[model samples]
Target: MTIKKKSRVTSLAAGRPPTARKPKSISRKATKALINTHHVLEKKKAQAIAKGDRAAEIAIESEIDALGGIEKYQLASLQGQRLDRGGDSSHILMEWLNSMDSTISSSAGAHLKMLEVGALSTKNACSASGFFDVERIDLNSQSDGILQQDFMKRPLPKDDSERFDIISLSLVLNFVPDAMGRGAMLLRTLDFLKQPDTQYSSGLRTFFPSLFMVLPAPCVTNSRYMNESHLETIMNALGYVKAQSKITHKLVYHLWVRKSGVQCPPATFKKTELRPGHSRNNFAVVLSGSSG
Candidate 1:
């Protein structure tokens, strides 16, 4: 019996489980390959976004560059000499002028006389008007020739029938303190163009055939009276229709037309607003003599 019991114990000990072995080390090359693949994908994504942003930025910068840079206000004075001897052609101005009706001639009349309101000291006004016989009316002056409150308040010009074929109002409207005042100013300006002794009299009544206005882009403002939409709305109310619109650089430009006898078409805002960084404001309207 003792011998049988000892043999049973030895069999039980032999049936015990074996110990577990340690895992093998990961290969350095395999680990590095996994990390590199992940990094490359992340880098590609970053580059794509950066490229997109850069393209947008370049588009805006190009417009501004075309406007002769931020020192554009100085353009007139710098090019003043050229103005007296006839100025160079501007791509922006030519493009704007050409976009008008096809019947209109690109050349100004032999003795074209122009009155530029809010004339920045730049050749832009001259270049846009095809270098017409231009007279820079300095609003900054206080003398008789300078624009006065009386002129703004008075009846339209009595003389000068069909005096000017084209009139440009660039960067002038915003200087007005409020919308109502600006509207009033616009009306008064039209009055200057009104035909003498006619019910349909407005500035350009017998003076100009077309008018162009350039303004800043719309943005948040502290002054409710000076918003962009208000200005545009006022213009529409006065029978002006947008003939052309463009955004170059960050600037916004619009051209409107008022024919002598015919009513203007309904106003429609152009969908092409200036982007944050365009380089120029290339906008224009042409009214052929035959359109009337």
Candidate 2:
């Protein structure tokens, strides 16, 4: 699909240099409405693509365009993350990292390299803290430092030297329109995370590869096909041991450490109802060809 030259409005919202143009002021309620509606339309578009329903896909595309397109959706998301607004989630990630190892913040030698997926701002807490060497990327970048690239399409590192010490997937998994895609995304992380060299000792375990993930609360708490336990099962099967987690009324945060040479469990997580509430959402993650 061809993306037109960025519209004037999009250019203002896009990740241009600070002098380009400031985004227009938009109320939080309006911003949220745009984001939520865009998410609904995106899911519809994904389903249409899955079924090869070109007509439905085009119609959904029209709706998304009317709703100001993916560019606007990304802008609203960035606004919502402003310090005066909900505050950047990366603050939580920074907190968890320090809590895990205070030395991580002070040790210059431990300048951990990080890949921040779906990044909206280059000045978020992690970037500002100077604790991590952050490489930010988004499908639609909104700042000068963040790369306009799809994480799913990024090339795998050729070796451990090129792999990152940490990978941040904040609000990224939920944005994936399908469960299988989410699973594949999770599995793909293993390929980019730096595996420890035999010469390295356990003393520097704080620098080991890890995944810092954040998602909206309902994706786990109120979904019929997913919950905390189910998510744990999937991550465990993928050899990620939960190191830290925090659940707020609106979001869930987790830090997962990769376990070298761990065996994947033969469990299959299908879209069966684990919770019996009619109000539950349809969020789920499915590993391909895995069986109980």
| Candidate whose lDDT is highest | 2
For residues 77-188, write the lDDT of model 2, one tens digit per residue. Answer: 8888887986989898777666655556445466678999999888889898877788999998767799999888999888776788889999999999988889888888
Residue 137 lDDT, candidate 1, scale 0-100 = 51
Best by TM-score: 2
lDDT of each: 0.44, 0.81
Candidate 1 per-residue C-alpha lDDT over 27-143 given as tens digits, one digit per residue, 9 for 90 to 100: 444433433343333334344445787665565555545544323323332343244433322333456654442323433333444555654443454545554555445434322
- What TM-score would you give candidate 1 relative to the actual structure? 0.44
Q: What residue runs in model 1 are displaced by over 4 Å at the alpha carbon?
A: 1-93, 99-113, 125-131, 141-155, 194-208, 219-232, 260-292
